[model samples]
Target: MSRDTAGTAPASASAARTGTARTGTAWRRMRLWGLAHAVDDLYQGLVPAVVPYFVLDRGYGYVAASGLTLAATLGSSVPQPFIGLAVDRFALTRLAPAGVALAGLGLGLSGLVHPYPAVWLLVLLSGLGVAMFHPAAGKAAREAAGDSTAAMSVFAAGGSVGFFLAPVLATPVLVAWGVGATALFLPPALLMAFVLVRAGRRRAALAGAARPRTGTDRWAPFAVLTAVSVVRSVVFSGLSTFVELYWLRHLHASQLVGGTALACFLGGGVAGTLGGGRLADRFGLVRTVQLGTALTVPALLALRLTPGQLPPLLFALLAGAALNVPFAVLVKLGQDYLPTRPGTAAGVTLGLAVSVGGLVAPVFGLIAEHHGPQGVLSVLWAVPLLGVALGCFLVEPGPADQREPARTMDPAGRSR
Candidate 1:
């Protein structure tokens, strides 16, 4: 009887110790993930706020400025698919931190350079860093969340918060200190790298503990979902790039009001991200995405028609709520469709979707130039319409057949 008691006591103590260790590790990893996301947010926000000013102030032509922005976006996006592939093939543990460090170095150097050509080159390099970081980090988030929808939503919210904070922090710095002040971002970037490195080591130690279950091939559903993501991306990009200017120019809103509106949109996104994840867990990913997409059309149309602050504000809030929910669910869907290649799913959803939006920006810019900024809002109506159409075709995968095996592996050795 004493022997039995002693064995049980040791086992119980071991389990408790293991649980404590896991909790500590999870906390550290979450912090690291948030930090990395913040770094991406800071740079993404800094570029748009400062880059145009830098070009105009420096006497570069509008064409040149546009080119620079396009180059940076292209650089950021083009490598993502490859990065996603690499994350799946090689495992993301070490590469994730390295990618963040590279992005930091690229962004830090962008400030040091002066010539327009040099700046463009540096932007391209920084884009590479952004491309590499996203897939790996997204994969880590999914793994950390243990494929739980609520957990993934919390993880996704980190990026939205980062996005919301970036403009608030970088805009003032850029306005006061100019683009050169971007150097300040380096320390945080480096700190995040260190944390990620430690996290990577821990992940590596635990790599063989549990093999992920095999997934299935559901190409028809994935194709439809990808189309929906593309449409969502288009709307998000338009709002991200033009919402402030639109309010100021069209509605006679002050710069402060315009900024506030932009903040509200992103803040709403942060709320939607968290809320949507919980909703997805309780209701199912398809239901959550469908409901969100369905609401988006009316919200966007309202934004176009509403003239007053109150109405537009309400529209913005609803639009944000609708627009943002799809992001977390889409990521979840990608993973479910290609369960064995969670990283790839992340790349396709987060990386490629954003890229598609970036590609669509010039078209919207043309519409803005031709039809005026308010007219640009009209273009956004198409996004949700397309999203709704595509979403109807999205079919949830079954448990034993989670992912489409063929599409899961990228033929190229890159990760998204």
Candidate 2:
């Protein structure tokens, strides 16, 4: 299928329905969607970055501060799958804009609202907005990339980049303008929402041209994929939350060293997410996932058991790669397992299923309180083995594995 996305303006629905309009879109649109994702997640990341300011500026206690996190998580992560189901049922493309806009608007309003519950409610609303953005945007990204995991990773990497950059982006503004500076973030979301609404209205031709050839919906395999994703999520959240503290407590490292180690872990994840797609493209998706799980075991165990301090940093990078190599692969695989409902697959992979780890994190915290952070790391070492066990239950993607050519052919029907 050829693409007709030379400019921002898309063809009319009538044109899309007729044979006149092109079926596919430009990769630039994926960039646009990716940018929208960054904007949505920037707010999600912004919450944590600003939470300290909320405490210092507003005199919030530890319990109050932690409650904000719970509110944000509950509002955002829990509703993702249901929101995804809504997107699949109605093909709710336009909701992406509303999500982004509300996310930004929530932050803006939070700055103006002085009361704690009101501010929490506003942030919760923002979380809801964040939840709304992923399913539909992910579904669109899947179509835009066709079946290319590398291309899909380009879309997913936006979130990682956003998360990595959030503190960088938010700190200076918060310092200069105070917590009310959250309002500054609103314009990007509002503008992006306007563009997405416009883009969604004109996607008829894009949808028609890029519709999947097969219409398979295998829930059983998708369930296995979700289970594997949950395990990966737990490991990722565990490392992200505790690795810095563990290094500081056990290795007797400075704050700088701990922060650097966390940075290494995250940087490895960004690299792994990009690399996983290429590995999947070459070897196959299921194989790629299994490889990640199998390799992750030793990496994590080494981080716990390595006698010296220096090797732990190397192990952190390896552990991050092993655990995250499946990030993009799992999203693509979920869609493959349920060819008819990419939106719902994206919802689980991108949303509620991943949050399952956060729920278990307190359990790890309890273990840490009793056995120390090293004990927490030791217990985490056993988690990846379950990923391998669940991975065995995954069936291969036959036709869904290669649904469409990655790039649209040129007007002359030659490869681009």
Candidate 3:
């Protein structure tokens, strides 16, 4: 019996060591994927930052500038589900790298070209590249993360950070070199693509094996979740566009204070994204999502009612955090709902659903015209109710509904 116990102890220790090593490797890969996501998304943020410069440098009219934005939006949002389907079918190993490269190239060249059509097309191509990156990177991140929501949040938060960084990073370059400084942004994308290629090769064996099949798909729940996501996006978009205006016009704050408010809100979103995953991991996904949706109502309401300039900033931060708590969870939940087609799930959740908010921005603009930014904020407090209501129908993916096959890529960048 002693001999038997001694023999089992060494084996158990060896197994423990092996498990620890794998976990470490997974984390390393997850961080790389997260950074790659940031690099890819930076270009998305750059578009809005670049648009104002195009008007300044090229003297484009409001219509033409809006057209350029429209081109990018159409390219990035429309074809995502189709692209996602392709990704699921073929598991395109180089898609993420190729997409990032294309995004950089398109945006970089937009400033160098003189013709409006040429600039528009280049921006369009950049948007397409963004469309390409999300599904593929999302799938890769998921495989690397396994079932760890906390790990997945790192990837999601990277995007928020990227968006936050873009205006900061590009403003100096654009100011120094004019719009042509967009070319400077290209190098980072290329560097990230190269890094991803190397990382993909090294981690091929580690992530290639298929995750055990956990359950079948549940479309109804996924549909409800998607609806909830759309509502969240609308509220987020409205706040992002109008928050500074709210501070400036309604609160009688200075431009610096207004800018600071926007920054604080975005920063809170990053924090909330990271915290959401941890919360979900501890409390269950659906519960965390519901909690977030419920919290948003009071946060936004408080922000709207707050009388002072400084006090509202606190509520703005809370509103941002509350609104974003479900952001990462929604992505993971979408994949879980349609376990057989993670790319499609990602495409809709990350791409199409989120983009819907931008479409609704004009509506909010009209509201602001009638009632001011404060009115817009007042309306936004009600949007989260839809999310909270829909969230009631969102069950945690049960054993019969939670399997996702691992997507594998060979060293040569081919799906195996």
Better of 1 and 3 by TM-score: 1
lDDT tens per residue, model 1, 67-178: 5556657877788888888888876576666766766677767777788778878777776777788888887776655555666665677677766775566556655766
Q: Once superposed on the true structure, which residue ranges of model 1 sit more than 4 Å away at CA?
A: 1-31, 55-69, 108-114, 308-311, 400-416
Off by over 4 Å in 2: 1-29, 46-69, 107-120, 168-187, 201-213, 247-259, 304-313, 368-375, 401-416
- TM-score, every prediction: 0.83, 0.77, 0.80
> Which is superior by TM-score, 1 or 2?
1
List model 3 lDDT by residue over 1-416, tens digit each: 69999999999999999767854654564677778778887887676566657756888644565566566767778889998899888848788898888888898888899988899899889888888888988887776666778778888888777766676677667767888888888898899888877866765655546553345778999999899998988887678667866877788887557656766677778889888988998899999999999999999999899899898889888988998899889999998898878888988888778766666766776687778778889889998998888999999886522344465433333444
Ranking by TM-score: 1, 3, 2
Best by TM-score: 1
Give the lDDT of residue 55 in candidate 2.
Answer: 60
The alpha-carbon RMSD values of the candidates against the true structure, listed in the order shown, are: 8.1, 9.5, 6.3
lDDT of 3: 0.79
Best by lDDT, which number? 3
Displacement of the residue 352 alpha carbon in candidate 3, Å: 1.5
Q: How accurate is candidate 1 locally (lDDT)?
A: 0.70
- Candidate 2 lDDT trough over 10 residues, lowest sum: 407-416
lDDT-wise, the better of 2 and 3 is 3
